[model samples]
Target: MTTIGILGAGQLGKMLAEAAAELGFKTHVFAPDADPVAAAAATHFTQADYEDIKALQKFAASVDVITLEFENVPVAPLKKLATPIYPSPAALEISQHRVREKTLANSLGIETAPFAAVRSPEELRRAMETVGVPGILKTCTLGYDGKGQWKVATPADAPPLPPGDYIYEGFVQFDKEISVIVARGTGGEIQCFEPVENMHRNHILHTTTAPANISAEIAAKAIHTATTLANALEVAGLLAVEMFITRDGHVLMNEMAPRPHNSGHWTLDGCNVSQFEQAIRAVTGMKLIAPKRTAEKVVMTNLIGDEVNHLESWKKPGAHIHMYGKKESRPGRKMGHVTILSPRD
Candidate 1:
């Protein structure tokens, strides 16, 4: 059996492991955690820190193909692997850094929010003048789930952050935040899922509704942009493109993820082919089917922290509960998520 290796052992890796089993593919999960959630379903588990080059090399050798579930892992070492790593190092390099991701998006003729880079107090002042107040200050690297970022609502509130460089982005006047999860095979076949409208609590994703209330023109643009990015980056696996839909109906690139993203989790039960399957197919040199939306209205709610602990409250019919089997949880931690397919009320 062909074995696929994943570089992270979080919920994303768990979901991917489950999907791989269904498709008759073995999954090898490599991570530093002693008991990663994915290891339950993983065909092979290699617990090693990201810095352990020897362990990584051994894990890479055991799998037929390799892909990463998280983009935060550095791309330098993974590039030296023998097997093909889907989405490629170029894609990881771009998505891992916010400044590079946004800059590449803008260079592709894709419009994003007005922004500037700040590496020092002086640069922060210049970025403030350019992007104005009510901007988001995000670290160029290692920022996810609203961590390593801050919001500057007013000029006076801009903190004296001179430790490291960050990216300053002017807030987009958006009606709603939407995302499109697109998959591209090794041969350039692309499959685009219906846009998903997202709601965030404390800058962390709270819920997602599929078939986003976007015009066909805007949706088309989103798909086109995602496809362009996949090809441009020579990405060989699934890619999730997040966009800020302006009040005027224009789609502005917000960010891109080089893996099975949180926004696409609904696909597990809301589509014939889940995002995990798509990622596996794309990386294994198989054809990626154009995703068919399973629910007319797919609504997904993230069960974060204590939210997942209250499992009794989510017993509503037609609700799919997927607990991540997490041993512990903390505030703002992503414990699990639930997806519901019901009428759009």
Candidate 2:
């Protein structure tokens, strides 16, 4: 059996391991953590610091192909591996930095919120002139799940600048937020799952409804934009494009994650081919399969913080529960999710 090496053993990696197993592929999960959630799902778990080049070399020698569950994994170490990595280090590098990501999107003619890179107080002040107040200040790297972000409602509201590069984005009045999961094969073929409308609570994803209550035209446009981005990046794996639909009916690109996304979790129970399976196929050079919704409508709700305590309450017919097997459940941490399927109207 072919062995697949996965980087970052989080919930995403756990799901990826399960999918790889279902497809008869052995998964080797590598991370610095002593015990990761994905270890249970993987055939082998390599616990070593990412900086340990010798450990990475041994891990690479054991796997046929390598892919990452998260983009924050150090690209330098992976570059030295003889094993092939899907999605390319270049694509991962671009996704890791917000400035590079936004610049790439804008250059591709994809509409995005006005943004400026600020490295110091003076640069931030200058950026304010163009982005104005009521903008978001985010670190150029390593920000996710509402972390490393500050809202600037007014000039005085701006927090003391941290010692690093940042990106300032003008706030947009959007009608709804949606995400498109586009999968690209090694042969350059692309397939997109239906767009899903997302709702966030306290800057963290709360719920997602597939086949978003959107006009066919808007959905088509969103899918097209996501596919175009995946192709432009020359990505050989799944790309999740989060977009904002304005009240004026225009779709603006928000962010891109070059892997399985929280928004696509609904596909696990609602689609014939789940995002996890697609990721495995993409990285292994298999033909990309278009995901077909098995249900008329599907709703996925995240179990965050103490929400996991009420897991039993969400257990009902047509509801699928997925727990990440995490021991500690702290505030704002994702514990698991529940997906419910509904008949089409």
Candidate 3:
């Protein structure tokens, strides 16, 4: 069995472990927190700070292959890992910061929101003037699930005269948000799933409906864009690209995650080979299966905070709810998610 070391212990990592097991792979999960959700099912696990080089080296020494759960894993440890890491350290380093991400996107002839690097109040002011108000301020590093970012719809909402560094991005006045999830085998075979329309609540993903209602031409563009990006990044594992579609039908690059995305979670029961399984195949150097959605329309809803505690009410036939086994429920925390696959009207 090919041994794999996963470099994060979030729900993504947890599900990846499950997929790896089915393929006869032993997974070693490493995270900073003790007894993470992934640790529950992973064959082996290590709890260590992400920056702990010694711990990372030890963790990497044991596995034959390494992959990451999220893009936030620090680049240093990934570079130090003994085994080759998929999705490429190059991909992680570029995708980690918004400034770098947009730079790369722009370099590839992809359109991104107008943005500028803000390391001081002056830079922020100039960026505001250059990019205009009704913008977003995001920390260049360590942001996810809407954390580490803020929107300034008006000048009053502006972040205080900034000593702290940030990336200022122009707000996109778009009609909808959509995402494409793709898995690229190490041998370079690429398989893509249908694009999904995403709805957000307070910057947290509320729901994702697959086969997103869009023109066939637009959908084709989205898929082609995703495939091009995955290949361009030399991505060797699962990757998801978030995008914004203007009312006029222009597609703008939003950002990306180097693992199975929240928007793709509906695939758990809605597809022949879920994103989890595809990720496993990619990282294990196995061939990827052609994606086949179980339903013409699939919807996934996240269970946040106390909503998970009352899941008994959501317990109904046809509703597949997954709980992360988190001991406590806090506001905005992703306690679990539910996937529902159905035919389109």
Best prediction by TM-score:
2
lDDT (10s digit) by residue, model 2, range 101-173 = 8899889888888999989878877888888778988899999987888888765666886589799899888
Query: Which parts of model 3 have CA positions greater than 4 angstroms off?
Result: 153-156, 161-164, 343-345
- How far is 293's C-alpha from truth in model 3 (Å)? 0.7
**Residue pairs with backbone atoms closer than 3 Å in model 3 (clashes):** none
- For each candidate, give its TM-score against the true structure: 0.96, 0.97, 0.96
- Per-residue lDDT for 1-345 in model 3, tens only? 378899889898999899899888899999999778999989999999989999888988899888888788888767766688998998898877788878888888888889999887667778889998889988888787787788876545765654655898998999989999989988889999889999999889999998798999889888877887888888999889999999998888889878888998888889899899899899888889999888767889999898887878867767898988888889999989998767655
Cα error of candidate 2 at position 225, Å = 1.4
* Model 1 TM: 0.96
Q: Evaluate all candidate structures by whole-model CA lDDT and list the values in order.
A: 0.86, 0.91, 0.86
Q: Which stretches in model 2 have alpha-carbon errors above 4 Å?
A: none
Per-prediction backbone clash count: 0, 0, 0
- Among residues 3 or more apart in sequence or in different chains, the pairs in candidate 1 whose N, CA or C atoms overlap within 3 Å are none
Worst 10 residues of 3 by lDDT: 153-162
